[model samples]
Target: MLELVKKNIHMNRWKTQVDTQVTLDDDFIVPDTMSDIAQVILDSGEVQLEPARVQSEKVTIRGKLDFHVLYRKEEGGLQTLGGLIPFEEMVNVPGLEERDYVSVSWKMEDLNAGIINSRKLSIQAVVTLEVRVEALFDTEAAVALGALQKEDDGSGELTFPQIATKTRAVNAAAIALRRKDTYRVKEEMTLSGSKPAIGRILWMEMRLSGALARPLDGKIRLEGTLLVFLIYEGEGESETVQWLEESIPFSGEVEMAGAVEEMIPAIDLRLVHKSIEEKPDYDGEMRELALDAVIELDIRLYEEQPLEILSDMYGVNRELTVETGEACFDQILTRNAGKCKISEKIQLSGGQRVLQFCHSSGLVKLDQAEAGEDMLSLDGVLEVKLLYLTDDDSCPIQSVTELLPFHYDAEAPGITKDSVWYLEQGVEQLTAVMAGGDIVEIKAVLLLEVLVLQPVCQSVILQAQTSPLDRRKLKEAPGIVGYVVQEKDSLWDIAKRFRTTAEHVMETNGLTSEELHPGDSLILVKEIVR
Candidate 1:
């Protein structure tokens, strides 16, 4: 009777599934010109001499003059040679009767002068000097003789090396001059540029076409190569990666200290040649701008992703594949500045399953979508959330049967019901033992698939049962008997097929080896008898 009752009992079970898709935001665009600007100053006019010395032949004369030198920096700051003299243009005048000396004085004046504006003026000048020599002689005859000789000898080389001779000298002094004078200056001027933007100036060649005057106009022509730094932000917590750092030749024009009210137009530039370098950590700091200066920039954009995922997996068992794509942007700047991009991921759960997806790694292009489709065609892992299945006692068949009552046939006397019947009965009993079986507890597992998709935020959930099965027939079916092993059949696979334990098969076959030869027969004992 027990066997018959068991045979009439039933068993029940459940399964869950989930799917997800990711997309990018399109609200962001390249910033416009004039957004990034700051004050700038080029403090000018500091002079330095290489070596200070007098002519070796005129040691006793002690003659030296300063090379009045100065730099016209961007800022209008003055530096001067206060007490030092230029050694190149110094001279000694022969005195008369051993009692006379030459005296010299110097001054500067602007030959061309003009008013630049209400607050500033432009000026250019040449320096001039004067010299005087006077003589005193205790012997009038010696002074007279020296005066007579000075007029006769125009070469100025004294004939007698050790004579007490002095000669009166009067002449315009020689002076050493710089290349040019007068530097352009802007009043309360400010300068600025962009950082963490596309492109870099590789080799800059600048030439001053016109001379700069104090508080006036100046211009320069610039030419160079720019290496473009491709910037990209990720979808999630992943950081922005630079795919390409390339250099391209470019050229443009520059002007400074124009009319104070005149605005400088943004210069348009272009690249003429291409070159590339591998710089992994270059510009890691988004805020720092290298090679600070205002110059026209030309850039070459690349379609490549720099990050390479080494490996990834979902949970402890499931392995995942990764996918990648690249994009780029280009622009110009007067100075250096930095910028940023953002991304996010969402997660949801139901019963014993979870679902997850992310919008990371900047914009998703059509090619990336096509690549994903190709992966699907090639049996590649999908870049979506997985449904994790966790086994819990709360959802036992016995508990399910008790919650949803079902009819069962009574066992007849003398004959036992099939093993399938007994199995069903066991499932019902186990399900009834579970408390409040209506709500099944679910768990989730997250995973990443390297080379498939980076920063893939994924999750799995336990969904509710869709259809309930009858357990009566399951209890009446004949149990599987010993069976021959196939070429690739495993103990776990065989056990699952018969709802039996691997231990039973090992013990029944007396199998000391885990390796099973084809055609080998093994016994199967059913674990869950309905």
Candidate 2:
């Protein structure tokens, strides 16, 4: 008889990803307080997502396109205006269920805003939303073997001495938590003496980079730098548009209910919503800028578990029939990070001349990650948009967008074609400057991160049926025998094959351990019963 011990494992059942495009069309009339639009210089936007609702084979996501337009006024100055365009989309996912967990992320693939007239603006945007669904389930794994029961026919209790077994160590990456939440970040900065106070806002751009999160005792500590750039009309006599760039370091802790130390954390964070406004400083002058942002966190935690399972087993004194089956487990291969640098020069056309560089923004798109022999190859493109000041009187500002392709290879030993991976990439640094004539140089540093996982399939003993030994074979067996150790042979294997215990064979051969060498001679002694 065989006694099996089992463990319950929580694992991912099914996961799938799908994307959909959402379009926004709207027209806006200029407010009386703001100047009429002369020429649209640059337009940018971000997506704001709500909680996705899941139904049978379908998911509905609702969000808005928060767009901003910087335009040259008819009176020879720049002004900023923005609004929200709401959208709703439903996508069909084949295996999705109502209770499944879903994560929704979006990017503005294309956004265009032009002046319908001097007093009216036309806005159009195409937003791509990627939805990921995960279903978690539990399974029982036969981990180990325990003591067997005795027969009622005046026989002793069965034990390991009467049977032989082999075991192997198994490692697993068990899921601890999968959740999505939001954290609020509020910060304020005052302008220095070298910079002028704000008369009116023209354009503002804020970016978060180099963010890291650590799991502590029931909380998560996050640290990063917020880059803020502002172009505003100064309150001085000139009333000219002056630019100021500031880097603010932010640190905060988010409350997580069951987080603890030493748990592997793969948390992704992004800016979901943000607000920037001018405020009065201590001297009652509008010299301070207040920033409030909402950051969305997608958290995944895994714990390492080690277990010993019976690989093979057999009876020594009884006829046993053993059954085995395979068990699937998830194990972590590696967590890798690398950087890719992109440098490109773009030439201006249509009689455009660069007066000054305003801002540069980039997005890293990971198109594919292919695994080869002991290596992980990454392919992606860096989409960069450059905004600058122009010398032309009609169009004082112009923007350029370019795509820079990048390929990176990271060392991922022991990776195979059957492995699963997840990638997270972002732009760490970006800069734009005039190289000469009408040529502009753009450089960016991209951070690439990947997590690889391999599924393990192990055969384990499921059940064992035992019966009394055959009396005829026992009578016909020799009382003493001679054996020779072969290559890759163990004392346990010799004993089990000869229907004897390892301890008995070791005692007969005066062996202190079960170690054996090839071509070694040994004597097997067994007492025959009839």
Candidate 3:
């Protein structure tokens, strides 16, 4: 006879489509006729991955991204061109079962653009798509009652609770903020003594500063400064570029139940639509610029749950053997982040003399990660683009791509090679200057956040029960027996080996605890009621 045990376990699954290349082509007409092109820049690209379908040996993901291409026309103005690129990719993930929860995200690593004609252009980009899933599996478990030591009473029954463990990545909240605000200012500096008329807006950068996300009143309250930086071509006898910076205070609320400051919240913001028209009201100079922008934000939260499990058990003293089940459990051992800074002088490429440096900006992307005994090593790239003046005073933009490698080891001593990692690299501060030998001396502070997950395989007891004694093989035993404890021996094992009760053995030997030492003498007195 055997006891039946039942348990539930939670686990996580995932698939990745990393290092995938894609092509984007567009044929757009500018306001002015085709001529010499000044510059081509990708304003923004976004992808929204749909739900994934898990197959026998793979997972299928489908999504589309909206990309924008901005260029300068020969007639001293900027042109805006855009198109939507649809994509589909298949990833191989072994042992994927149905009925698993899945989440997906897409990221852009590198993009290269070229001019095919006056109104036609071609762009290529490397995109990475990742899918993660959470699932629940049911299992059985049981432990046997102690083996019979005395004569059968035909009155004792046994019972045990059903115990199981499940691990899962739960979504805490989702936040969507719609902000419609205005910025009234007369602060940006003009190129000449007089305010030259604004020619064309070249590029704009939106950054969130001093941002705080907290849960309150069954909703997520976000407070931060929406910083807007604008670069434009100031119209004059000679074409000149001017810069304008503004910090617009914004406060909004979104409904997110159970959202707190500790749970990980990933925010993705986009300038869905924007309109800025210059309005100079009777000042005889440009003073007020009406600002209107539609900001779209997508926020998803995730939390990890890890637990301990119970496997098998058997009755003592009675004849019994336990059956166990084996499985590979995937769990998030540790998921955390830390703040870091990387300071180094980046060497310039060749004989370019620096007259003056205008502005510096960059993006940090994690490429790969590896784990040691107690540390996690991360590798990534910092795509830095600088706008500066040459010795000849040419204002063409010069870009540089550099590698940023770092190691993170703190409060982590159990990290192994099979651990999976993630990063949310943020650029806190980036300051630079032109050195004596034309080197770009840079001082950058970064928020190097990391997430580590280590999954291990363990076996648990499935079921156990007592093996009945045969009446035909039963033999009459003597009233007393002599016993000697040996090395690596336990009271329960000794009692089970001698077919006697542990309590009777301890009481007879004058034992105080469950401990037994080698060469210790004991007397076993059996009180059978046959």
Best by lDDT: 2
What local distance difference test score does each model get?
A: 0.24, 0.81, 0.55
Which lDDT value does model 1 have at 372?
25
Candidate 3, residue 144: the lDDT equals: 25
Q: Order candidates by lDDT, high to low.
A: 2, 3, 1
- Writing each residue's lDDT as its tens digit, candidate 1 over 394-461 gives 22111000011222222222221111110001110011111132232222111111111111111211
- TM per candidate comes to 0.17, 0.88, 0.69
Alpha-carbon deviation at 408 in model 3, angstroms: 4.2
Order of all candidates by TM-score, from best down to worst? 2, 3, 1
The better candidate by lDDT, 1 or 3, is 3
Pairs that clash in candidate 3: 5-141, 9-165, 9-166, 10-166, 10-167, 147-318, 311-460, 311-461, 312-461
* Candidate 1 colliding pairs, count: 63
Clashing pairs in 2: none
